[model samples]
Target: MSNYIVRKLKLEKTPQLDHLARAAGELYSRTVVSFWRTVRKKNIWLSGYTMERWHTSSSLHAHSSDAIVQCFYNSLKSWRIRRKTDPHSKPPRRRRWYFKVIWKSAAIKLKGGKLRLSNGQSNSPLIVDWYWEKPSIIELGWNKASQCYELRACYKEEIAQPINDGNVAAVDLGEIHPMVIADGVNTDIFNGRYLRSVRRYQNKLKVRLSKLIDRKKFRSKRRKRSIKSKQKQLAKLNNQIKDIEHKLTSRAVSMLKLRGIQTLVIGDVRDIRNGLDYGKKNNQKLHQWSFGSIRIHLEYKCKKAGIKTVLITEEYTSQECLNCRKRNKPKNRNYRCSCSFEFHRDGVGSNNIRAKYLGIVPVVGLMARPSGLRFHSHIQCNLTDNILLGNPRDSIAGE
Candidate 1:
């Protein structure tokens, strides 16, 4: 399988490059707005004919114009698809700046320790310091937050498929556990309580900052600085969370590969929070959950390893008992059924998810007498030996 990775190159800031970037951004924004208006008025899709008609008199360089048109077309296509799925979807909005570089030899050139960028109407290229190997595609853009020009180089790489061992694993995602996996032989529960704790702490910090800002004078320089500092802290926290998630998902994928799992079944809960009223506190917690991000990590890692991934609707996965097949409403972290089956709530959900694909009701005692059970948490612990039935307190102990 072929996949691409992007490497960012920070360009040296200069007056000339800044002007060029600003001009490109303005031109891109105008082109997008005009193209969108034409599509709406003519009730037609974006195409080369429409692009040629719209930009015939434009002053933008040929390559730059082509790149902007392509980007707009792709965005429009995606918006149209989303609009069909969601009737309330709105059309794309115009931006103050929308800089982008279309991949072309004329638009961008690389040399020893420096790169050349096309300034739309100039014969001479804007030269900047950079050092990188040639890439399949190069894109340039300006980051408003950082106030700097950035280059993104895309390089394609081959992915190796894992050797198949006829094993399948079912994954259940939840707010508390994050991921619960069942691979026939064992059940593993990954604790997400630490993540929840971190989120709660961050939320409290934000609330304190908000209250302080509200009490301060309007448009005060002190208030603005405070807000900026809070924003920086929040951004740093978010980056840390992302790093932790990457490590957790990497470990999960490695475990699956080691077990020779060929197929991965993941429960899909994307629409679980749609149009549901679960009270204020519960809703806030649900919103804070990173279910989508976790799924994305699992999917790409599995793809890179050539392991098949299937997303099955998770309706009633948690409510249905894996032991007796009776419907049970789980309370908190425990699941109890009328047939005397009791287990970790998330584990039951994951086992049932695997059973769904097997087209059979799960055996009553499978979860109770699993071949093995493993507990993992984000915090450091001495349970690194991978021992079967290790102390749960050591694994899930508070950080």
Candidate 2:
């Protein structure tokens, strides 16, 4: 199996490059909109090749135009799938003036210490400084905050051999604790407090910036400067959030591999925000939750590490007491049952999820004291000193 990741590089701003990228965005919008109009009006589906032919006069490379068509078709295909379950699901109809420009393998070249991106036959090629091997595809994307264009290179990497030891683990995903895993014998909790704090700071900064910008005249020099500064800060915070996500997922996968775990089950909370109305503050926090991003990172990293990931509905995984088979929503981090059996709430959820997936009854005697880990920016992961539930205090150190 093969796995791929994207590396983003900042591109120096130039008038020619800016014009080219904006033109590519226009071409993308025109291609999608034109094809969609044909589909709606003529009730016909235009093939990618046919759409590519329609863009013969485009300044973008032939392969770049093909990428646009491919993107449009993918959106249409996704909409088709969603419409089966969601009757009100709409097709891709929005049009944008500036879209990210993608160049396929055929339009990319690397020579010596330079990378060349083909625009078209008559236009000058975009040659940039390069030191790494050529990537499979390249994308020129606009950064509105910095008012610049950047490049993203996608490269394929070989995947590790599949782990077939048959050991399985279940994960409970939440906003406070991003991931909590249990494998009947071992339990691990990954802390997400830092991620939440960073997001909170971002929201506060955004509000302050918005207020300051609103106080100034619209489109004035001060307002524009404030807006740009705000965007730059938000972008920096966004990057920090992404850094945490990558490290968290990577560390989790690495630990799981070390545990000789093969299959990973993740609790699905996809619709947690559909009609959520838990007051202003709570609503904001939930809306900002990035479970989808965490899941995506986990999925790809697991694939690369030859670990299977599965999602199962977790309707009562969190509240149901494993000991008494009764529902009791924990008020805090610890869950206590009427039968006197207690454990970390997230651990209990993970255990129940595992039980549901494996079609086995949840047993307290089979579970171990859950170990806790807190993620830090300076370190990969740090073991937290937490009191073990129903086990010796040295249980974490033994692991």
Candidate 3:
């Protein structure tokens, strides 16, 4: 199968480049808004004719007009789709600064360490740093914080499909453990205690900052500065969280790849927090947990690695007993059944998730018991050291 991937590289910052980017973005946005107004007035959907009408009168640079039109069409398509589900969807609004410029093949020229970009007015190229080979589609965008432009190149390549080794790994995602993996033979647990602690600290810091900002008078310079500082801190914390998620997901995927596992069954909990009444603290934790983000990361990585990913409803995976096929309510992290079978709650969930695909009840007897269990922690915490249970086995017996 073939897939397209986008790579972003930081571009050198210059006042001239920044001004041009903003000017182009503003022009494109204005054109889009104008077309949207016309469509709304006529009660007609956006089409190439509507875009062509606006494009003819647009004062945007010739070099960027094609790209602007493409952007407008894409946005209008999205808005139309959204409006189908939501009649109240509004048209695109005006933006303060336009930040991106799309360049056609002829508009960009790359030679050695320098890039020549068309400024729309003349043949003279705007010089920028370039190291990688030129791509078919090039997009330049401005970064407000860094006061620089960014380069994004898009390309496609073929990827080999992963071979099916008949081994399957089921993942159970939770707030406490984060991720629990069972390949029908061995179990691996990824602890989330450190992540929770970091989140709590960040929340406390945000509250302290908010109080300090509120103590200042409204519209005061000191208050504005405090607000800016708080925003910066929040952005920094968000970046940190994203970095951690990327690393954890990568490690999990690497582990699966190493074991020659072909099928990955992930328990889907997308709407787990839809209308739960878990009180103040618990609700806050649930809202902050980035389950969706983790799933996305896992999916893309799996796709690129040629691994088949399946999502199954996780309704009773955690509550159902594996031994007697009876429903048992778990207390804390341990699940106990009336038949005298007991095991880690999340581990059982993982096993049952796999069973859903295999169409068989997982056996918990000594012969089919997991040979060993591995514990991994995302963060370096003394309390969550890796522990191995029983003797390690060559492969998980998924009978």
* Top candidate, metric TM-score: 3
Clash-forming residue pairs, model 1: none
> Candidate order by lDDT, highest to lowest?
2, 3, 1
RMSD of 2: 7.8
TM-score of each: 0.71, 0.76, 0.79
Q: Single out the weakest 10-residue window by summed lDDT for candidate 1.
A: 382-391
Q: Rate the local accuracy (lDDT) of all candidates.
A: 0.71, 0.81, 0.71
Model 3 stretches with alpha carbons more than 4 Å out? 32-63, 84-88, 104-136, 144-148, 160-165, 216-221, 338-340, 363-399
For model 2, the superposed segments whose C-alpha errors exceed 4 Å read 1-4, 14-16, 22-60, 65-99, 110-114, 119-124, 127-133, 145-148, 156-165, 218-221, 323-326, 381-399
lDDT by residue (tens digit), candidate 3, 1-399: 876556666778776666767766776766766666777798766676556556631333464666766676777679889998999987566554665777776777788767777766543457776555566667888654444677777656566776663688899887887778888777777767666776788899899999999999999999999998888787777767765666666667767777777889999999889989899999998998878888887787766666788898988989888888899889887888989988888899999998887888786663143322223334321121231111012012211
The candidate maximizing lDDT is 2
By lDDT, is 1 or 2 better? 2
- TM-score-sorted candidate list, best first: 3, 2, 1
Each candidate structure's count of clashing pairs: 0, 0, 2
- In terms of lDDT, which candidate is stronger, 2 or 3? 2
lDDT of 1 by residue, 1-399 (tens): 787666666666776556555656676676667766766899755675567556621334567667666666677778889998899887556665646655565666688867766545544666666545556667777754455677777767677765552678899988887888987657888767667777888899899888888887899998998888788777767766775666667667767877778889999999988999899999998988898999998897777656778899888888997766778888877888888877878888888888897677776554443332223435332222442112223334432
